[model samples]
Target: MCLLLNLFHLDLETLEQSNVDGPYEPMEADATNREHETEQGGTRFSDFIPLDFEEEEAVEEAIRRSLEEETVQVPQESRSIKTLTTEEITGIVKAHSEMVVTEGFRSIIVSRRNVWTSAIRQFRRPRFVESTDMLYVTFASDKNSTEDAEDLGGPRREFFRLLVKAIFQESGAFEESPNGFIPRLSVSHVQNRVYRTIGQMMSTIIVQGGECPALLSSVVLDYLLTGRMFDIRVSPEDVADLELRDSLKTIDQATTDDDLQRAIESCESWRYQIEGLPNPVTMDNKDAFVKNAIIFHVLLQRKSCYDQLAEGLECYELLPLLKENLPLRVLLEMPKVRSDLTADVVATLLKPSYSVLGSNKRPKEELMVVKFRDFLNSVQEREVEECLHGRTLTEAEKTFLRTLNPGHILAFVTGSSRVPAVGFQPSPKLSFVHNENKYLPVAHTCSNELEIFVNSKNLADNDEFEYNFLVALMNGANFSAV
Candidate 1:
């Protein structure tokens, strides 16, 4: 959970490094639209592909023709006529792997600087997108790497991290809160379709087998999912305006009419905000006034924003899934800090492939692998001391220490900081990196494979292996080519 927070904080630093910060300025909207138009005119994967309508019609026509004339010949020599049951038919089709339907891959290339804009433009392009299309991401910066299902995982994970920051922090679509972000009441944002686009991105991430946003207020998610707000409550601290919240807090704590009147007079907005309130408030109705204020500020004010966000979420058939799948729904709104990527869970889930194992006795290579496993378990046990009184470390040393953890290793190998609710597909692999000269660990994130240096000389050099592994993971953390 702390790692997840660090990941978000790291994303913010990336945004700052890219020289892009804050909400969209009024003047920048036109420039963004123009850039989007340019993207449409530039080279696009969508242009080569035909629209869904034409393909569907052609497929249907072909199927109709084939069914009308096709006939199957069955041998009738001394055979009893027995009807096949539904289960039997299903079993027959299940036997053939090719006959089963599988998710399609949707490949997208995006610039790191304009990830949100480029991704949305590609999503909106006229093309057939399967509801369950696995999103394959490629950052424009990575020019040498080939696009394959295995190689896309790292980029895809990083894409979600960046998109989370872009939509919530950079887009200025929602108000920041300690619990989660609440939708801000903004007519201009709604009119610009900001909320809807962000909603579509959120749903796209989920359907494409990526990380959930998990940054929305629980109340907001409940309303969006069920279309009803039940047992909804908001903290007084959730109120963004410091002065107004303090005034309400004072009013709520007031005992007598004099104290209530004084508290109410402190805030000028109370003159018109609450209706039918006695000028000199009494203890009897103070609670009711506070409740109304809370409702007005939290729910009623952002009603339109919520509606727009809901519309966006329904973009890629997410509504039904949210309604039907309890776990997914919970995960989508689960707080970022609630992630359960503990060391034990990650170590248990990793699938290792031994390079040397044939005799009854354990191979030295196997022992080194076990040593590496023990190191992963101890990652969280070791305190990450970034400060040493007044001494400062070199840049390389800092990078090495910062990334020496189980979470970073999991992310380095799997492309996600948190474990998926459904768990990892093709479980993360532990393989040995055999070289005469000891080398750092290499992670092929696309295939979820981690290669540790386990050569003959380095089998017992535990400290050397640890140093090389941490340095390698840190060096390649942002290198998405693998």
Candidate 2:
């Protein structure tokens, strides 16, 4: 399958020149042909796998062992192990391939963008005439476009090149594809990350009490940009299908009143009667129904809980808007938080990231792992949590600490790698350093860009939410000058 994909495929240079940019008005003949293909039971691009292969448990075990063989440093403090993301797996796979990973190739692997799906559609055109999701789709210019040919755009073609590189990184998969390897596993991996991201964001709101417009905009923008909402999407064609409807019923991620109604209707017949039983769907009532639907979706049977939420939404209007908004649209265009920033923060915290078994650390070199969240709140301009636990600093380090500017906001992140600390039996106390970066000493902060140094994964818990509230209040009060 990989050989065929590589062999029949046009070179990247050829795709660049094959101009396909035009309006949406496809030829009547092409449309007729597509309709005929659907009538004749042609496989849709979404459903097509390169081969009828399922990955074996043995393959999974081998991959796991390969990862285990690579050394990992155990933290001084015990922690629930973090799960490896697909992006990290990509790196491991690349390393195993004994490939010299160039920066350009690495970018293609780490990209959350739909690299593979869009490319394969064009590669397998004619039979796979159906389109993959792309932002600025280039149509063949109407003048030149004929029943014989259609042009896919430059960006679309470039992605296929990236996809080819990604497959090469997982070179074993190319061979495994014939037996039972999922060629589109990369797409699925990214899609899962997107879903997890959404879950984390939603968790932030519900658990962390960040119901403010700012957090909402952040979540909406991430959701829009990632484009994985399509995973839960119920296309118009599938709207009436039981499988699609059941999925809607299960997920209950409706964005509008229409979607909400569809969700309730999708349930067994008895559920439909209850939807309009309270009030007919209307402009005035959609919001009300939506709130109920959310409650129903979550609680299912707990009527008292639904009443509890209804009482609150009526008073404060805290109903979560699952639909797109202007805030979301405006923020989507802004740049994302660079992964390197997080990487720097992580690097500074972990002394020896990976080590061989039974390795020893110098007495002074053992790191003090402070919860980053605490450090941010404690500092005026900056902080040295090391001092609190009796890790005395030299005169030079102290002088550097004093130089921290109070005006600059000291950046601290959540999570830390486990590290050894001295025996200090004392009550916890808060401390801070000057805010200015001028005082920062020593190198390395963000080490692992892909994996955050998370001490706790439950971002929505009560403590996390309350922490956000206090921080917001402090910031708000600080700005309210006379």
Query: Candidate 2: worst 10 consecutive residues by lDDT?
Result: 415-424
Off by over 4 Å in 2: 1-482
Candidate 1 TM-score over all chains jointly:
0.69
RMSD of 2: 23.4
Instruction: Give lDDT: candidate 1, residue 41.
Output: 31
lDDT of 2 by residue, 246-301 (tens): 44444345667676666556444433534332355544554445444432332232
How does candidate 2 score on lDDT?
0.26
Candidate 1 lDDT over 76-118, as tens digits, reads 2212434332223222322321222245677787777776677
How many pairs of residues in model 2 come into backbone collision? 29
Q: For every model in order, what is the number of clashing pairs?
A: 1, 29
TM per candidate comes to 0.69, 0.18
